[model samples]
Target chain A: MNKTIIEIVDSLEVSKVYAELSDPQSGGICVFVGTVREVTQGETVVALEFETYRNMALKEMEKIALEAVEKWQLNKVVIRHAIGAKKVEDPVVVVGASAPHRDACFEACRYLIDTLKERVPIWKKEIFKNKTVWVSAHP
Target chain B: MEILLFGIAKDIVGKSKIQFAAGEGQPTSVKELRQTLESAYPDLGRLSSMAVAVNSEYVRDELILKPGDEIAIIPPVSGG
Candidate 1:
């Protein structure tokens, strides 16, 4: 059996994510953190604003975690996403995976983040010096 | 029925939810609802892509909107 933790909050603490994925039987724990960048295509970004259809996002993340555990045979999986405004370098997401060995852990970690990007219902917008725009959407 | 909005869609709609009369007095399919929205808010038509969710589940545009069904407009996702 595997454990899955999914959260959507205003901020994320990597240590907390690491703590959640810690397992005595696992030799490797892979963690991924995504942060707001200061620039995009040469434009300075002041901040990032993230939003979600909370219920749907949660359901989708949970499904991904459960499926990753089955496919990768992982021991544990954790995903945390931050909402609201975030400054440059502020962590926006933390995904962690632990397995009995390193291979499954790394693959599951990558799968979780990649699948989340393709399926999760969260959205982010870059707040530039004078205006805000979605990462990619109606301009 | 109320159509909920999020992200850029919320900004364009100017609110989180709005009462929508998709088919007046009859059942409205998801595609028809989208057409009505596009007509009422042309800005929505500008979206690169969008989907409608029923009861927290994203379904095809052909799914009919029923009374009391929870509807949401999902824009392109960019979360990492």
Candidate 2:
């Protein structure tokens, strides 16, 4: 049976996502976790904040997960993103996939994160000591 | 009509949501809404791109809008 898990939560738990991706029929599992970095272009980032239009974000995430499953024939898929302020080294996003083979799961995991970033309604802000910048708001 | 704003759009609009009265010459389509917003807040016009969501789904500018529809201004997204 194929399973899809999508969530937008206050915090991200990689372990929970790992559990979700574990499938009895799958032999390969691949996961990707996005973290908050302390620096960006030499600016000291104090923290990173994420916000979303929750309803729309969930709808879009479901669309991405479905597409990955179809393309890669994945047995399981997990896509979760964290909202609110996150300190450096904190996990902000986790995406994973399981398949009968290694290549399919790896490709699907990449597709999940890349497509989510392009189409989802989530936004991120970078906080510094003196200012805050909304990521990718401008050219 | 009420429109939700997020990210820098919220910062530019100074609120997370905005409403238009019944007789306020409200926009009837996504394209018109974009024009109305750009004229009201020029800074929004300078962004790399902008998209609108109607009832939680992305729609083209030609899509007609209704007063009771859920609308949102989506600035360039930067999510992982």
For model 1 the local lDDT of residue A109 reads: 87
In terms of DockQ, the best-performing candidate is 2
* TM-score of candidate 1 to 2 decimals: 0.94
Candidate 1 wrong stretches, greater than 4 Å: B21-27
**List-wise, what DockQ does each model earn?**
0.74, 0.92
Instruction: Give candidate 2 regions above 4 Å deviation.
Output: none
Give the per-residue lDDT of model 2 (tens digit) for B21-51. 8766789899999999999999999998999
Clashing pairs in 1: none
Cα displacement (angstroms), candidate 1, residue A112, comes to 0.9
The chain A TM-scores for the candidates, taken one by one, are 0.95, 0.97
In order, candidate lDDTs are 0.88, 0.93
**Residues A83-106, candidate 1, lDDT per residue (tens digit)?**
999999999999999999999989
TM-score of each model, in listed order? 0.94, 0.97
